[model samples]
Target: MLSEKMIEQLNEQIKYELFSGHYYISMAAYCASKDLEGFANFFIIQEQEERFHAMKFFHYINEQGGDVKIIGLDQPKTDFKSLEEVFDLAWRHEQFVTKRIHKLMDFAIEERDHATQSFLKWYIDEQVEEESTMLSLLRKIQLVGGKGHGILMLDGELAKRQFTPPAA
Candidate 1:
């Protein structure tokens, strides 16, 4: 069974994940408006991934005999000044998520919640990949530097991204 505090924290994380999905979808819409289909596809995949993450937490909490509480999600930004800005925000968000996952792991250790700790290990690894992918994209964007052809090439690369959920 999950401790009340842990349950609360998990619920909060669920909300954050849902908000991440919303944020990515908004980014995808912005990219579509800018005629960056590849970028839009990338964010579309990201949005699906975030939704999966939230559902994973939801299922885990219920499996642990905890009630899944729904929390309010803040509105996500619908517009970005440039692709650089979008990638910057995405990288920053990944960093934030990594911190949050680390905190959850710390709490699990302190509470001797071995099950939760084991489950969180997957998330820990996932965050690493998430940050790495975003940083790589950011670097590519930086190298491209507003060149139309370079941007198109980068977009094509991003469109190739496919989400494979980690096997539990």
Candidate 2:
């Protein structure tokens, strides 16, 4: 059974994951407005991935005999100055999430909850991938001077991205 504190933290993480999905949706809207359909598709895929992540926590909490709480999320930023700005924000968001996950891992270790620690290892690895992906995209945008034909090519590449949920 999960301690109350652990349960509370897990519930909060669920909220954060859902908020990430919402934020990605806002980014997608911004991309679509700029006629960057590929970029929009990429964000949409990211949103789906966030939702999947939230569900994983939800299921894990339930399996561990913890109450799953549905909580409110703050509104996400909807405006973007440019594609580069959007990617920069995404990379920063991923870093924020990585810190949160590490904090959770620290708590689990402090509590000596081995099962929770083991479960969180997957999320830790996932955050690494998330951060790398966002940073890579940001770098690519910068390399292309953030405009023109290169941007279109990048968009096309992003459009081909599809969400494939990892094995649990």
Candidate 3:
């Protein structure tokens, strides 16, 4: 069973993950409104992935015999000036999540919750991939200046992205 502090932190992370979904949902709307269907597809997939992450944490809490505390969802930014701004926001959000994950890992270490720490190793590895993908996409957006046919070409590229469900 998870200790009180560990349970609290895990619950908090669930909230963050849900908010992360909302963040992507908002970006998806912005992308759709801009007529960037491929970019929109990317964030729509990201939104699904974030909710999946939240559910993973939720199930982990239950699996660990802890009470799941469902919390309110905070608002996310609904507008952006350009595709570059959208990807920049995504990159920054991923960085923020990485920092939060580190803090949670540090707490789990301090508390000596071996099970929790072990579970969080997945998140640690996931964060690396998340940050890397966002940064790489952001750099590409910057390189192309997100204008004219460049973004359109990127749209075609991003359209090919598919969400591979994580292993059960």
Question: Could you say which candidate leads in TM-score?
Answer: 2
lDDT of 1 by residue, 1-168 (tens): 899999999998999889988988888998999999899999999988998899999999999999998988898997699988998999999899999999999999999999999989989998999899888888889898955899999888878978877576
For candidate 2, the C-alpha RMSD (Å) to the true structure equals 0.6
**Candidate 3 global lDDT:** 0.90
**Cα TM-score of candidate 2:** 0.99
- Tell me the lDDT of model 3 at 86: 83
Instruction: Itemize residue pairs with steric clashes in candidate 3.
Output: none
Off by over 4 Å in 3: none
In model 2, residue pairs whose N, Cα or C atoms come closer than 3 Å (at least 3 residues apart or on different chains), thus clashing, are: none
Using all chains and alpha carbons, the TM-scores for the candidates as numbered come to: 0.95, 0.99, 0.96
Name the 10 consecutive residues with the lowest summed lDDT in model 1: 159-168
lDDT of 2: 0.97
Residue lDDT tens for model 2, 53-149 = 9999999999999999999999999879999999999999999999999999999999999999999999999999999999999999999999999
Q: Give the 10-residue window scoring lowest on summed lDDT in candidate 3.
A: 159-168
Task: Give the alpha-carbon lDDT of every model.
Answer: 0.90, 0.97, 0.90
